[model samples]
Target: MKCLKSLFPTLMICLIVFGCTNEDIDENTVNESSNKNYNSPNYPIKSTTELIVEYQSGFPERKKEDLRKKYNVKRYEKCDCTNSRIEKWEFDPRVDLEGRNELITQEGGIEGTDYQFFYDNENSTPGVSGSTAAGQSDLLISSYIKASNSGVTIAILDTGINLTRLPQSYPFLYGTNSDMTLCEEGEETEVSGWDFVNHDNDVYDDNGHGTVVTSIIIDKLFDEDISDYQILPVKAFNDLGKTTTFTLLCSYLYAVDKPSVSVINMSFGWYGPSGSLFPKFILENPDILHITSSGNDGINNDDNVHYPSSYTSNNILGIGSFSIKKRKEIVEPLPFDSRAMGISLLSPREIIKSTFSNFGVTSVDFLSVGDQVSFYDNNGNHYLVSGTSYAAPLVTAKAAMYYQNGHITPTAITEQLRLNGTLLAYYSLPIYYGDRIIE
Candidate 1:
């Protein structure tokens, strides 16, 4: 998991060489100021109140032209546009249709048959480790919190969640939709969500990475032993566990709009700071809390911090991983070189008894699932899991618990966690020079 850092090529070089220096930048700044009021709307555009409709049966196969005319839909070369067949439709603002899509009967199908409405509901559970003291202790402490997360919403910007695989007894641990049924009268319902990879509403978890992360936070909240927290699963990465900058931005925008969402857990990272899209957004909205991973790549010869985490923002909490004793065995220290100086906390990263860690690592003589191993549930059902991807959720869940109890702010939480982190003499050296061990 070395951080990927490619040197800037010709394009970047040209930008740097002739890019606005202080003298030339003044003219650009003047131009920006002069046009600031022009074309800028006096008020925010009224956002359309739209809902997604998930067809129980996949879209009917028919001539594209005929289908569009009959269903009042439009076919397009791409699905990203407003009039596309799979595009979101805006209904009347005055009407409350439970976010359901109205259906019309066709010559071959029945009319008035209701299909499930798909809203942009961030969904997923957090993966829980059954071993580590922090993991187990947090579970025990959550019981006394008495918070059910009925009103609070937590957004997981990860792979996705497998609703079918979740335990039957703990339905709330799944997401906004509990029974896997359509919108209910009293029960929590899916708010709104999207799949950045497919650009569709189907953000299902093909990769177990997301399922593991989601389980950590959701499981703790809903476990009869702990408090219940609402989950908003926003799938940014695909099966390959990769995503582009644009897609990640879209997911962040969606999280920002979630009315009930108070916290966002981003357990992913990229190298180098390009633009400040995420940081600027968080700065604009100071109330939301963002928790991000400090990255798993052990420190390199150079001591550069990772992006997003490196962004100096009070709203963001960067996290690192540590190893703890589990199952009568002492786990080895994480291979990642730690450089989180200002605000970062280190937690266990060994093969502890987590929902996703089933395979034993021989190198460390530990027995828990690896980043690519599949793990089973308490009942013996199995799924694939791996990575620092899973560790981030454990921290996110604890942060949620702290937030639920009103114990800390986003900035304060990181301060306390880092201040309380067990200091290691091994991390005292300069990561790059690898010589002096400064206290």
Candidate 2:
């Protein structure tokens, strides 16, 4: 060995550095850098990291400090939604029970329409308020191409879907991660999509926003062969109907990689940096089309910048609200343009406009009638709700139907949609998605 080393000194030096690398570890344990012994587990490998909160019973106040101390966390701020007011614009039609003139008790829909299924609860019960969506009427005409609706999945990244709310006929199968499945008591009640807020498998809806949003898709496509379509119910928000972008980000990552999930319906938005990590992920995975609601504040997103919607990613389609028909007494070239860009089927205001919907000339790409939109409620009942949240799923349903019809690529889906739309909100103001997408 000594003679060999002397003969080939440079070669011997290389042997010493490389050959003994793994052998230098503690006898029982292998060194981290050893290629020979190291198992090539796929990684940066994503996994959920939960903050363990432990405290004695009856110690309510101690929960915060205990978690901080245990996790060794520094400068912990509340992980709730930043602007609560902005994110929460969903309004039930029964806000003031007295002014129920817009309300109509129907055994079914209006005489000569196929919209009855869209407004029916589990049993087609009466007492559903508001009116039919003009966007629905517009899509029936404009987007003539009927995509293959088979196997198309849409992830509802909101307050999670209540499986109980769905009727037996609407046999939509939700996703389940056995490892991360959540529960209430001893047993796991509902093992469906992950609850990012509570960190469980019980992705049940508490606030009803998710149910309503999910129903929008069903209402539109139920007439078609929607048997094979999947709905990924991801619960990012909690019972309070509040959640942070971080929570949403976690759910966003989970849904992007799932099989057959090409569409995501995000009905909540606030002023946050969507250009950051979220858009990057969506950009990398261009196959998925993230359709987000252009909030309900009735403000211009060009200046204010509602997040997720305002994000300039082609894959991310931001939708504003508009009614199809003109509201009474309000005459303009841009008729039915709600506060944002509405075409009222019925008016919440002087005529009927989506009273609360954010608009943008540059940021928001498309507009749909969010005013007087009917969706299923949390209690297996149906009601009409008003907001851009309701409007967003209209685009998602179209995107899904488009995907079904062969517009699989995000660019193709968006471009084709834009080309079909007519101009709204002043001749050329609404751009990006051609004139006005849908109607």
Candidate 3:
């Protein structure tokens, strides 16, 4: 039951055995014929009974009230971080939504339903044993890099963070006090992250995905001796790794509300029509760097889009996974002696694309070592997890290091990584800008 890094390659096998299936095909990936086909089988399933509507700037509150009364909204949740421009309205089930889509659009606004997004990785084994505290300490010491401390905060929107175990296990986080959590809801701060799933402030990682993802970011930052940095945990997903667009939007609003938050680490996504409010959220806030996983579906994202990662925002960096010592399929062989036929020769290729990692020439921005990454679960059990989910945090950590050196803008941080990263190519096509973070 010890930490098993060796099983990382077979992580996809575990997911398949566990019955991971693609139930939805996103809009970008769907054929033109399905554009007007709302009832198409490839359409993403709605996760909630709620509908999110974004109104025009300075929209009348009286009109909002009238619309609420007309639509029979049971209650509404604020989807805006700064203002009440966007709201998620929970309509009574008895109300007919036959023409709601068109009516809402005619009200000088756009509306969308919540779609479910899953955590990008799956566990290989059922259990492992170790004190997260000791394992983290060992990890820090082994990956230590000589550098000065810098105060850069990263906000993570995922299955929440392990509040109880994090304070005791990860030295970089706090359990209480002024540095507790940086949630800015209603001009008030909390002791821990805000949980959008249960409508509370308990940011505990029940599914362990958040903890493992957080560990990777912390590991990279700790390696550089960065002690002043802060991590804002925003729990958007539930324990079962199922989350809706409304929940994710709520999480995004909360994360962006904190002005101190410089980067957002989103390791979860979904395949859908790309009509969610998330794309607008990222576009509106260009100050923060958003790093997301491309996906684990081993498909070309250009053809079959993944949310957040496939989002064409300059501020967003979509990351995929790669591994060393992988035997890449040789489409064309290197120049060799004609007599040496059938004898393999050492190709210049040093890394191979992960079999399960999604990629696209324009969608994914970079690739990182996602296989066999050492991480600890929420229950203090060490493990070896693999996915584009883990790969993204590596880039996020590198971006943090760049931010430590005063690279504040997303464009600047991305440029710095590209300049220092290893350029990777496959056959003849260059996959991503910064092939991988050098560190």
Query: How well does each candidate superpose onto the true structure, as a TM-score?
Result: 0.49, 0.57, 0.72
- Mind giving the per-residue lDDT tens digits that candidate 1 earns over 1-439? 1121112111111111112111111111101012223222111112234432222234453543453355453222222212222223344556443433343323333222221122221112224222111111223222223233364567888876554443433434223334333221223223334556655544566554565666666654554244545677777876655564445655676666655577787876654432434556667666676766544444321234455555556666544433233223223443434444321224322112222211111111111112333345555555433344444565566656666666446665544444443333232222221111001
Candidate 3 structure lDDT:
0.62
Give the top-scoring candidate (TM-score).
3
CA displacement after TM-score superposition, residue 317 of candidate 2 (Å) = 0.6
After superposing candidate 2, which stretches have Cα over 4 Å from the reference? 1-150, 175-190, 272-275, 324-355, 376-382, 422-434
Alpha carbon lDDT at 34, candidate 2? 21
RMSD, every candidate, angstroms: 19.4, 27.3, 11.4
**Predicted candidate 3, C-alpha RMSD:** 11.4
Candidate 1: where are CA atoms >4 Å away?
Answer: 1-151, 173-192, 222-225, 300-302, 325-375, 378-386, 415-439
On lDDT, the stronger of 2 and 3 is: 3
lDDT of 3 by residue, 136-192 (tens): 222332222223223787889887665344423434542234533344455434544
Candidate 2's TM-score reads 0.57
Model 3 scores worst on lDDT over the 10 consecutive residues at 1-10
How high is the CA lDDT of each candidate model? 0.42, 0.51, 0.62
Model 3 misplacement above 4 A: 1-43, 47-49, 56-62, 79-83, 92-98, 108-150, 164-189, 326-349, 377-380, 425-439
Please give the lDDT score at residue 289 for candidate 2.
Answer: 85
Give the per-residue lDDT digits (tens) of candidate 2, residues 1-439: 0000011111111101111111122212111112211122111111122221112224344543553444344333332212111111112333332222123112122111010001101111123211211112222212221233237888888876555454433446444345542333233243445666665555656656676677778766665455557677788776555654446555776676566788899887655333244555567777888888876656677777777787777678888776444223423333333445332222322211233556555677777757656544444454555567777887888877778888887888886666555433332212322135453
lDDT of 3 at 127: 32
